[model samples]
Structures are given as structure tokens and as C-alpha cells.
Target: MRRPFEQLPRSLSPLPGEDLHGFVLRLAHRLDLTPIVLLRHTGLIDPHRHSAPARRMFMLEKDELAAFCTTTGMSPQDAQALTFKPHVDSYPPVATALLGLRGLSPAPRGVFPVWLLTTSTRYCPSCLAGDGSAIQQRHGGPWKVVWRLAATFACPEHRSFLHTTCPACGLPAQRIRGRSRSLMVEPHTDPLHPSRCRNVTDPEQGPCGARLDSAHLTDNDNPSDDLLNLQHRLLRARPYGTSSALDSLAGHNRMTDLFVLAALIRATWPLTADLAPSPSLARALDHDIGRPGPAPSLRISATAQKRWDSDVFSARGTAALLAISARILNLPLPELRLELRRVIAAMPPLDDAAWGQTWLNLRRDSSPLFRHEVLQLLDQRFPRPLPTHVALPGFLLIRRRSYSPKAIPQFLPEEWAEIITAPLGHTSGRSPGKTAIRRGLAAHLIQAVTGMSLDDAGTYLGIPPAWMAAWGRFRPLEERLHGCRADLSVLFQRLTDHVADQRAVDYAARRKRFANWTLPESDLQRIVENYPGRRRLLARGSQRGARMRVGFSALVWSQLTGSEWRLAPDLQPLPVEGVAMVDAGVIHQLQGRNPDHQPFYTYLHDLLPDYASTVLEGEDHQ
Candidate 1:
């Protein structure tokens, strides 16, 4: 067991908005001891444990926090303020869950995605030179927690881009390498100033020890006023403020939206070159993101592409990319959609497969509103009719609450047919095989409204998977009814409108009620009593009778519920020939083509409603 920590004789109060790592550095400096020594005394690190500390140390656990607070005599709330946990709701990048870094020991080594900046932070030289207060004069000023975010590019107070790398070492300030876990480069070194560069230049020699606060800015380091304003807007949106200004701009997800837009701007570089604010900013972006040919993947190697992605978060040339991204994000939805369309149209001609892959990637990374707009642009660019055999992409589906699959039938309902035809105008005297087209239309509607896949919708409607696979042969006929894109859109909208306006039936209840239902034996016998031959055909115990019983049950099921007869309970086991015979018999009786069978049809029509009411009664009780 480790010894308990005693209150320190001298400890500095944490500065406002200071980060946990920076506070540790300043506290160690105030007591004239090394950071590692202070951590050991506070029981934060075990000397016997040779392994390096984990990155999670920055976000201390309960017991670890208690020990640190006890030794420093700082309140828990004040210590917690030095960490990033409070800002997670307003700032997205620091949310460890989003970065896939939550609960990780030492964070993995690699080029992380542009959304997170974990390894290092950019700094404003003037801020590090102390605030002229007594405590800051003894130990350097606070290293702000906000500086670690990739979205924070410019220093609003200084009116310039934050410095990317140290002047002497040419490495990022306060960088934590893959194998190293300590926040400071030289954690064991005593008497080093908090604002000096501690990066290890050589193993044998000590750190670079260059004074960071002494670095000066050049003319080019200053950015335009517009870029500064953008930075200010972002700062106002941070959690430190009483109210987020960005909430009014893009709602709750404004930071995430901005990050996604910046990523897209970086990916599609000079293709969006015209959107750049100034000539100097354009050159900076060009240096960071090289000018590629028509397709970015074709010109850039995989390694170089990874580096470019990393640079989007780095201080090197990020201002230009973010400036362009902010402008695009500020546009109204209509103008934003048009601008995106123009950018996509400017790309060099590529095959359909390549374009599809690009769209897939965009859909994967985009926000919901952004994804919807991109899909609309795609629909305009490629007006191919919806395919019947394959699943529709998610973007094409209606909202889930709009319709239910159980409410749709195998054939288009008569009421829906009337609504759809109104928008189609005259058919030019061409039949176009309305029955087959109607069935196809029914399948399409199930998928479009309920968000089911083509196969799932077909199965639900009593269409076999094998039959759907062979639907390609009828594509030509389906195309005739589709007419032009405008007609198709109008027809679909009308159908959707009708569905939304009407009260939905309890089809799920009907399905549950009829799942194991069969017509009573007494009712079946009474209908067949008129003709002895027909009665014998449906007699009990015969193989043919068993099939005929299922068929009769299916016929009655179709009468009670308007669903397809083929989906009737206990009917799937019958052979194809038996099913065909049963179907033909049912059709003959219902059509009243045979005068002799007219009485039997009348009896069935009268009996079904009574049986349906009984089933509904049971459902009500349940």
C-alpha cells in the first residue's frame, strides 16, 4: 500500500479555464519540484509500476482525484473545472466516445481522423507570457483547454493563427508521443520554467529548454478580419458562455455540422477553390492539400492522403479550409443544395461504379440534413427508375411513421389506384398491362413508404422470393407506366398524401387474430350440402380433402380481410397443382360464372362478417 499524501506547504490556485496538464506543470513549478515527484506524493502514480501512465490520467478517476485534491487542498469542483468533461456537450471532438478513445489505456498511435486532435495543441505566444497577475508572474499563465480542439484554429485575442510548432525544436508544443504517457516532455526535470520548450532533442543531452513566450509573430501569421470573426463566433458557442450562440445558427448539432463540412471541404480541395476567401488563404490551402487531377484518389497515394487528413486538424493551413467551410454552412438550405450540386457537377466524368462509391462515402459521414440534400442532388443527376428486385437505398425511403407495411396489399388498392391515375394524365390508349404494373407499383410503394427492402416487402405481400428475382424480365413493361420523372414523382406524392390523410386500419391486429383461424366444420359442410359431388371433394380424412379445406379457409380469409389468399394459414404445405386447382375453384365460385355455385358463394359472403366480428371481439378483450 502507498503512503497517504500530506497537504503541500506551497500550492498555486488553478487559473480560470486552465487545462489539467497545464495546472500540474504550474503547481510543480510553484513548489520547485518535478511533476513526477508531485504525482508520486499524491499517489497518482506507483513508482514500482514500470509501465508508462495511460492517457486517461488527464481525466482522473474518483480515487485518483480525491488523492490529488487532498494533497493540494483544492476543492473537487475547482479541480474538475480544469478538465474537458464540462465542455463535452458543446464541443464534439473532445467527446472520447466519438473518437473511439473512451476507456483506452495509452491512446493508440496513428493518424486519427480530422475530427479529434489528441496528441498536441496550438498556442498563442502572447497568452503564454502571463496575465501580469502576482500568481501568473511567479508561474506562467494558463494553457487553455479550448486550444486542443481541431475546430479552434485562430486566437481571437491576438488576431492570428496559433503557432503550429516550436521555433527551436520545430515540433508541436506539449506533444505526447506514442510510447510516452507524461504530459510534459521532461517530467523529472526540476526548476524548468512552465513556458519553456521541454521537447527532448537528444537522449544524452537534456530538453531544448527554449523560451516559448519569447517567440514573435510575422506579418503572414496574422489572418484577415473575416477569418477572425469566424473564430469569434465559434468561441462564443463554446460551453464557457451562459448561452451558446451557435444553437441559433444550426441548432444543437452546430459543432458537429461544422466539423463535417470542414472535412468535406478538405477532401474536395481545389475543386472548391473558387470558394476560398482570399489569394493568400488559397495558396495556404494548396500547400496543405495538393492540387489533384479529376479524381483525388487517382492522383494521390494512400500515404499522402492520410497525411492530408491529419493536416486538416493541424495548425498548418487549417484556417483557409475552415473559412470556406463556414461560408458553405451558413448558406440557406436551398442555396446550399444548389452549391453542392455545382461542385459535384464540376467533377470529371467517371464510371457509375466510381460515382456510386463516392456517394456511399458521403452518406456514411454526413449529418441527417446534409445526407438528405446530397441524396436529392443525386436523384436529380441520375433519374433511373426505381428497381423492383433490389432494396431501395435508405435516403430514398419515406419517414418510418408515414406508413406501415401491414396496411399495403399485394395488388394496389382500388382507392389508391384512383389517386395515382389522376396525376398520370392520359395513357395514349396504350393498356401498358395495368395489372402487372399495378402489382409492381404495389411492391414499390411498400418499400418506399415503410422503409422495408424490396424482398421483405414482396414476402409480406405474398410474392415469392423466386418470383421477385425474375422480375427483371418485366422491366420494359414497368418503364412504360413510369412515364417521365415528373409524372412518377407526382404519382408517388399523391399516393403518399392519401395514405397520410386516411385513418390506418389495425392490420397487425387482423393478422394476429387470423394467424391460426379456420372456418368451422359445420359451416363448411352446410355450403357443400347443395351438391353431393362437391361435398365429397371436401370430405374429411382424404388427402385431396385436406388441401381443399385449406383452400376453403383461404377463400374465407380473403373475404374477411382484403389481404392476398396465398398467405392464408396452413396453405403453404399444399402442392403447386393443388394450390392452382383451389385458386381456380375459388375464382369460379366468387365470379358466379357457374349458376349452380351461386348459392354457395352467397352463403360464404354472409357467414364471413359474423366470424370476423367474433375475432375482433377477442382482440378487443386482449
Candidate 2:
């Protein structure tokens, strides 16, 4: 028979904003018992680890906590709500694993959130160092769940930001007390006391037991109380409601969307700021920057790029970035919403590829919401109006939206005749096949304006030749293709505008992959001598001559060889399209197969058609 556990003589009342895991530890300490002993008594011990010597008091599961609460006469609801459950909606995966949500939910398999949290816990030092009187009265200040948020910079009560890494050892704050049998240190005996750095960096030496409190705070970059209040509200807010439908479509929940928004704001900033025209946002960013002098050129460092690209961010950085995004939305700094309607409204058409590149950078591995938001913004900016003069506007608009061209009312061959040819006063009695006229006009326009074949122009516009054939299917072709008949000036203006827009999109996609690459001095010299414009300096040092980037070099080579080279991968063993792994013996055998004994390049070309002409050093194919 299982022995029945009894309630404690003195059970600690739940403190305000206290996490249940910490509360349980405090309870165990007050009971003069080890966490394992307390858990065993409460019938919550893991059978697998029950007999195992000692273990850290990591987070507890829902069932275990419920059992603990039942045994200790504490309300299970209070225990759960006080723990990490409050933020589960924002960071579902961490909470799901922490709480073992699969055991709680009916259909838990596909319910993971798109974003993740930092792999460490954070806490406010000042909040932990309460007065002794307060400690004796109700234990101590609680570990507020608000501090767990990546966007939470400061503790309103402390007027200082939460600390994560220890100052002494630079190790992350240890939330789960290390020892199972006893408290790690004397100061930490009181659960609410500020954590001391107990990180053991050297086995021979004792822990760097420095107290983690605001008394030793060095930075003065605390956000104002108003900002902190706004952050508090934003962090606590959940993504439940009608707006979540948009989140569902975009494959992101509310919290992940906020992260994407912050990233986009940081990436675009001043350039996109002009589109929204928010004085409040400008003022907030300026205040945070605290630069009285003329704002220096905004050249982002490589370190900053890596930080921005990563999903994780310091609370201070996240808060500042979110503030700017809030300003762009024209919402009060305190007001928060999960939907992107206002944000999309503020976004200007992504006219430049750099803007598109910024969107791509922020939305990488992100939910569909980011891409949908961009497309919707473009649609709002340039609605595909019935082509008044030429198909160029229609094509550009359709291409920008990235929706099916068939969905829109396409221009007919007669419409093209009206725009391309001078106004014929009398209607012609004879009309040719609609498809033929449409194809001829499309071919003529593409060749004349872009100076490329029909196929190449289609590729540039992200449309297939087969897809273009279906365009204007309802109309008939009557006349042979000829030179454009529209006003010369109008044609030139339309062509330039269309081409410029297309180029911006293309450039942005290309630049997104471009990076600073280092090459050997010999390769650098060859590139500079052969293609001066292609060489770009990335870094330079005394011992090593200036290292040049190979992004443009790779792009030039791709164009020359008619074979694509992917620039996204590491430069060391670069990623190519058609290269295959072959043994040295295979190469020897293949070389021997040539009856006339042709060069190795010839045999390699026979194996991979595009490889022989470009990769090998020989007569240029072009």
C-alpha cells in the first residue's frame, strides 16, 4: 500500500509574481527538507531518478506540481499560473517541453510556436534584495515572470535592467540550484535573495561567489518607467482573438510576429521611416541613441549584423527595437496589438531590392506572416489597375504582388495595338488569332525594351514562357509583329520605369546573398586585374594584404559560364550546381577511356557538360 503524505505544519503562502519552481524550493527550504525528500513525500519523484544520488532542481512538470500541490494543501491553479505557463503562448516549445504539454493537451503534436527563447533564465537583482523585515514577513520579493521575456529590459520596481550573465565569470545565471541535498550558498538559502555567481570555472578553485544585485550595477542605460510599463503590458498580452487568424495563415503566433516586426524595423529603420513619417518614433530612437551631434553615417558592423540576424536578442535591444516598430504603427507607446494591418499600412512599396533583401533577412525560417505582410503591403501600394497604356505596368505590378497574372484582367492584343501602334481611326475588318498577336507583341516589347529574348525576359519577370502564352487567351492575333507604334517618349518612360522597378527587386535578391569574403592574395590579384569592378575589399591587415570579397566575383563567373554559383554557403569548397563526388581512381579510369588521349578537361566536360568550359583553365568558351 502507498503511504499517505500529510500537509506541512506551516505552508508558505504564494508570493506575488513568484514562479512555482522557485516557490517549491523555498517551501522545501522552510520545511528543513531536501527538494527530493519533499518531492518523494509528496509522491512526485521520478521513478527513474528516484534512487539516483543527487540532481539539480530543474523545472517540474504539471502532473508533478499538481501532486506536490495536492500533498502540500496548495492550490494547483495558483502553482501553475505562477510558473512558466503564463508565457507559453509566446514561447510554446520551451513551455511545452518544460511543462510536458503533451500530457496535458488532447492534440499537442502540431502546436509548436514558431519562435524560441534564449536557453537561459534572467532575473532582476534589485527585486531579489528585499529588506530583512520583508523577508521575514513573506519570505522575499518574487521572481516575476515578466523578466523571462526577451523584450523585457528593465524592472519597473528596481529601475534597472535584469541581469543574465554573471559579471565575475561571465556565465549565465543558474536558475536551477545545482546541489540536490542543500542550498548552493548561504546567501541563496533565502530563495528570494539575489543569486550569487556560483559558477565553478576552475576545478582547483572555489566558485566565483559574487552577489548578483543592482548595488554593483555599472550601466546607466535603464529605460524610463513609462517604457517599462509599456513593456510589461506588451509581454503579458496573449495572442487570442480574431487577429490570430492572420497569425495562423502566416504560420506564426503573436510573439514570433513581434520578433519579426522588431527585426524588420531594425533592418530598414531610417529608409522605411520616411514612408511611415512618425515623429514619435524618430524622437524615441533619437532619445535611445542619445547623440546630440549630427547623426554619423549608419554603417552597421559585422558583429551587429550577426546579432540582428539571429532570433535571440538582449532584452534591452529588443525593447528599443520594439519601441521603434510601435512608433511606425502610429500606436501609442503603451498600446499593443498582434495584427499587422496598421504595420502593413505604414509599409511603402518595397521599390528597392535592398528593402526586399531586408525583408528576406528578417523573415528567414520565419512564419508565412512576414512574407504575406510584405505581399499585402505591395498590393496596397500598387493595385494592378487596368493597363492604361502598356503591359509593362501590368507585368511589373503583377510581378511585385507575386500573385497569378491570370487572376487579373489581362491586356488583349487589340489593347496592345491601341497602345503600341498610333491610333488607327478606322477599325480593321480582319483580325488574326489572339494568341499569335499577343505572343508577337509580347516578344516585340520584350526584345525592344529589355533587349532580351522572350524566354530571358520571362525569366527576369519570374514568369514562365508557358504561363505568358496563357496571357490574353480570350483575345485573337490579327497582325504580324512589328516595331512599337506608341509615342516614343511614352514608350521610353514606361520601359525605363518598368525596368528600374524590376532591377531593384533583382538587386535586392542578389545583395541578400552577397557577403564579405576573404581570398588568397594571388586570387585577389587575378580578380582585380581581370575584372576591376568585381573586386570588393572586405578586410585588411599588415601581414595579410587586403582580402577581397568574392560575392560579385562568383556572380560574374556565373554569368560568364552560363552556370549558376550559389553565394550563400561558405567560400571554402564553394557550393556549385552540378559538381559530383568522384573517386581518384574513377578520374584515372575516365582519363584512360579517351582513345585519342584528350585533355582531362574534355573528359570532365563529357561527364558534366557545363563544368569543363568554366572550372578548368583553358580557352574561354564565350
The pairs that clash in candidate 1 are none
Cα lDDT of model 1 by residue, 1-622, tens digit: 7677788887878887787777878888888888788767765667664322534323556776788799888898887677655554455434322222111121223223334444566788878888888888878887877776666778888787888678999877876554444444567776678888877768688777888877888887787888788787675552112354434223224555555555456555687778887787788777756533211112122333332223343353677777776777678878888777875565433232222223322332334577566556656665563222322222122322367766765656555765655444534222335544555556766766554556666666766665566553224343444523333333455677677666776554565566677766665666566443344335666665555455567766764455556557656654544457656576556545557785646555455566566656765799
Best by TM-score: 1
The most accurate candidate by lDDT is: 1
**Stretches of model 1 off by over 4 angstroms after superposition:** 49-54, 96-113, 178-182, 237-252, 290-316, 346-367, 378-622
Q: What TM-score, computed on C-alpha atoms, does each candidate reach?
A: 0.55, 0.42
User: What are the lDDT figures for the candidates, one per model?
Assistant: 0.59, 0.41
Residue 153 in candidate 1 has what lDDT?
A: 76
Task: State each candidate's clash count.
Answer: 0, 12
Error of 2 at 578 (Å): 47
Query: Please, what are the lDDT tens digits per residue for candidate 2 over residues 325-352?
Result: 5444343323433334555455444443
Q: In model 1, what is the error at residue 31, expressed in angstroms?
A: 1.1
